[model samples]
Target chain A: MRKDRVLNMLDNAEDNIVERLSVPALTDNEKERLLKMSMSKLEGMSMNINAEEEVRGVDVYRRPRWHRFVSVAAAIALVSGAVGTGFLLKRSGKKPEDSFHAVVSPEQTTELTTADTVSTDVTTELATENTVIPGTSETTADYQAIAVDLMKAMNAAELASSGMLNTDANSPLASDSNYFKIVDGNIKGFDFSTMENVRNFLTDNFSGKFYEQHSYFIEGSDPFFKEGPDGLYARYTGRGSIYGWDKYEPEIISSSEDSFVARAEYEIAGTTFQVDMTIVKSEDKWRVDSATSTLSDPDANNTNNSNPYVSLCKSKIEDKWNELTNESDNVSLDFVFNDLDGDGSPEFFLMYGNGEYNYQIDAYTYKDGALKAIGNLPGSHTSFAVDTSSRKLVLIHAHMGAGDYSWYTMENDALKVIKNEEFEYQEWGSNEATSRQDINYLSKGCIYKIGDGTVSYTQPECPINEIPRSNEINSFTLDIVDQLYASAAE
Target chain B: MTGNEYRRLYAESPEKAYAALFKVYCDYVYAIVYNKLNRVAQREDIDECVSDIFADIFFSYKRNGEDYADLKAYIGTIAKRHAINSYRSLKLRSERFSGDSDEEFASFADDTDIETNSDDRETRSILISKINELGEPDSTIILQKYYYDRSSGEIAEMMSMKASAVRMRAARALEKLKKSLAAAGIML
Candidate 1:
């Protein structure tokens, strides 16, 4: 932001504060009323309303909402681990249903782990896992300095007011920019792919502004400093709707204050997202970066079940010609589904986008499938993902206009992620999980609903055979993958 | 910090949680209710909802203990949603008594005279100001979506957008008002 404009916005904002807000002291009657309104539901909820009956009985039972409202002196009582569980969830009056429950089930999940780094928080607790920043070895005074530098890189209003944000009318690259990238470095493990094949598969299957995107404008210190005083970039770009496929850009802020992090309010898609960026210095320069932003594929915890269909598939593929569109000057999307020949199957894939978030994808499946991506406005075809689960073909893409992931499964004839659950990639580093010593996260992951379009999440308890194993990240997600792999090996 | 220590504290006194919750969320709650429920003449109700959410949060902590994950995220998510739910749900329920219940609720957008042919952004800001006046979830969801540009699906998961009917109702209420109010040449 121009220094003058920024200062002006701030001044205007300050002046408007009073007219916009009026603080009133709570009266006796008002306090009583507030107390009742507050506890009516909480009194019943203090329990894991969604937890299993047996689990709820295990001491984390429902408590009266009024009980917790004591003064701060009383608040110290809640410091206990066991007692704290009650506040996690409120119970429901309805009788037991299926018994499974989850809170804040985001549509996207990311995983990042070095091919050499081994397991993760969800997997084993690496004996030498460095979760904290290695450089913070000094005392509190050192951290204070680091925090101060972070504040220097702050520039949120500028990003929020950028032409792209104001409207496509001003976005220079609105209709033409298409490039797929995964930026990762300073912070380890924060990496993902910009798969054109996956997005193309989605475009073919959807109609009416085929994809979606959830964006954010964060002002934080750069984790990897290149020179001078590091500044936080107006991180922009879009992510696809496939729960975890979302992209964000880095818009550099001008400052030398070191690393001070402040999240601008970014509410796109149906959910609001706040990116937490950590700052660091390298090569005598200050820069704002995310711990989980990576372009390279880390060691993949993958399992592909393939077979003899290769011979026939290869022959059929050799028999057909592939079509490619260079229509997008900077972006080109091409894909040949291994399920070639319209068969209901998925195989090999390839493609590309114009830039940080301009993309196109086309998937031809012998598996009896086809895809179509319709772009309506700016940020055009950022990036996307595709997978066929539960007989229904699921597609994920990002919208240029809205900064949120759009989920679509072929319905009738049009592809639509008309539900909020369909959006993904709420925030940068949302999936970026790092150890205290490591500069970057070991991996990233997102959780989403698969059945009945309802949220049902599973943490990869046993991320892989190499993980050292800990109960921390595991406690957050279900390890269905680990279970499956274990059973399959058996 | 130990589990037993925390439990003993809560057992010794329950008000501890309420006080704690209040401090942690005072700014946020005040911002939401004051902004969204502004038209709600019952200042008592607005105040009640704020304190209630905190009290409820404290009790919830005492009831359902969580040792891991960011505590602020956990509580904020629940509190914000509850506050909004109460405002909207309460308003809807009160309307069931349509006959003589002193229906003084006026259109928040009644004051706006935005141009009908205004561009997307012009229409967008008008919607934002009106929603902001209504406060909380209405403003939260609208600004988060239209202003920030989030999808409805993402919103649904973060919040209990609940039945499509409920969401449709909120959307209809918002969209209709934005559309109609934009035509208010004088206000625009």
Candidate 2:
């Protein structure tokens, strides 16, 4: 057997064995160096999360809810500026019917207005007493529009709070935007020049318990923001980069004279979620009271059960199990599914052994709804080895201090022999043996005979023989396969 | 750190909590990644993998918002998976540019092998028991020099001894290990 092969096995030994072998303590300087490196990478990930458009190929997940809230709070600090006022006024001026029609498709309009029609009976009666028309299509459209506006305003607040809107140098909030400041290449503080602007922004967009919870505007009440002599300032809270919702599409689900519940669909990190926002009229102005989100697509959240790839694997395993069981009464079959080629698809590895030292393996992958054989290894004196980094499968057969090594790789859905070598070992008297060969493989006509503490290359007396590929599945029972599958899944 | 302490610290200060978490578990994470990728990857790759693992753990904790009863186990699982991914990526890239012929196959073989065997667990257990019997600096020397593949100077720094002394102890320890394994009817 190869010495490196034995060492690799020991590298992945049991947890107790590993712990015993890896006992050298790291110096304090080493720990500090590693910590600094980790912190830098994490900071980079955080920046990518907060970016408006993810860096070209970077993979980012959704930002946590708490960070979004803090971003909105920061945006509120700039409410006194012209950018905030212009955005609010531009949004408020659009007629409810016009805004509703512009924002949603005709099909969505019908669905949302249908829910309003059933719930607006009481509103119709109240409208009849006044000069307003009762149960008119315009009235129903108005109700849906109001709910849509509240959702839009909340989303706008999050965008502005995220610092995406005022990034340009000419923007009005750029120079005086003191709510968040970068120091030493980090966003470290939250300090506003005016507290009244934040209070007004919060009061206009949020109300009731939701507003109370976000009442950092209340002097000396919340620990996050403080009203000191040098404007309203907050200590650095150590939160990562701030991000806003990528998109929000709201449709009124139900409506009444006083309230409307809107379902808003939004996308973050390429995944969609639906948030049900409850909007209520307080002091004659619509405001968002609360909202809760659920994943929009069932399959996106439960891939293991619905994934077609998993189904294909399970089906093929069952077929192979039946075929093996029909051929023999006592057989030992075991298998594992791994993405050996880093292709994001697991390849099936089926092993048939005699419950002793000899074992054979056959690898298969699913393509066009059929199992395609990718690789295989015949039975050997020891189990086959997989080099995860190089994606090579090695088989070694050893007996009487002689061994043959065959290295295989998947090429065009077939295992191709990449390298082959044979070696012989001899021990002299006094238990002395030659140092293991550190040189590269010799030409095909040469063989390595290690002895007397020296490595010498000599022509082989006979031609070297290659190990034959075994692509056919050896018949075996299913009991061991089931256990192996369960273990692999875990 | 206990789950409660981490939660409390996270609430009070996330930066402080991250520092505490890294300080407590960096070595364990480093060892796991280093052992898996040492032969195939460069030192920089190993360092980057360790950092990526911690970043993943921190974000996962933030996203799940659940209290981990066993924080070490959670960290260990993430570390192992990340190391494997790093190893695969590095290996694939190297294969694309490698220019070795059959004459270099033996050296190539020495650099690539990552096999694990449940069948060998019992034998490994016996071998580890023998190594532990060699005692203190000797045991550490053998493991650090052979298993970890650390240089004698590096092992000396960790054990606070001279490099020459570390090499001498390692040689003697290997002899004792061989004799001990022979007594158990095993030969190297």
Task: Compare the candidates by lDDT and give the number of the best one.
Answer: 2
- Report the CAPRI category for model 1: incorrect
Note the B-chain TM-score for every model.
0.46, 0.78
* lDDT (Cα, 0-100) at A98 in candidate 2: 35
lDDT, candidate 2, B1-188, per-residue tens:
97678899999997788889988887678778877676666677888898888876676456334455557765765676567556645654454335655332222234354554555776788888887899997887877777666778888898899999988998888888889989987675
**Model 2 clashing-pair count:** 0
Q: Identify the runs in model 2 with alpha carbons over 4 angstroms from their true place.
A: A1-9, A52-490, B11-15, B62-65, B100-115, B162-164
* lDDT at residue A465 of model 1 (Cα atoms): 11
Q: Per-prediction DockQ scores?
A: 0.06, 0.14
Q: Model 2 chain A — which ten-residue stretch has the worst lDDT?
A: A444-453
Per-residue lDDT tens digits of candidate 1, residues A1-490? 1221111111111112312322222323444556566666565554444342223222111111111111110111111111111111111221111011111112311211121122222123322332333344332233333322332222211112111111111111222211111121111211111223223322322212111111121111211111111212111221111111122222222222344332222222112223344444455443444322121111222222232233333322222212111221121222222222222433333222222212222232222232222111111222222222221222222221112223334333322343322121111112221011112111212222111111111122111111111111111121222222222232
Q: What interface RMSD does candidate 2 have? A: 15.3
Clash-forming residue pairs, model 2: none
Clash count, one per candidate: 143, 0
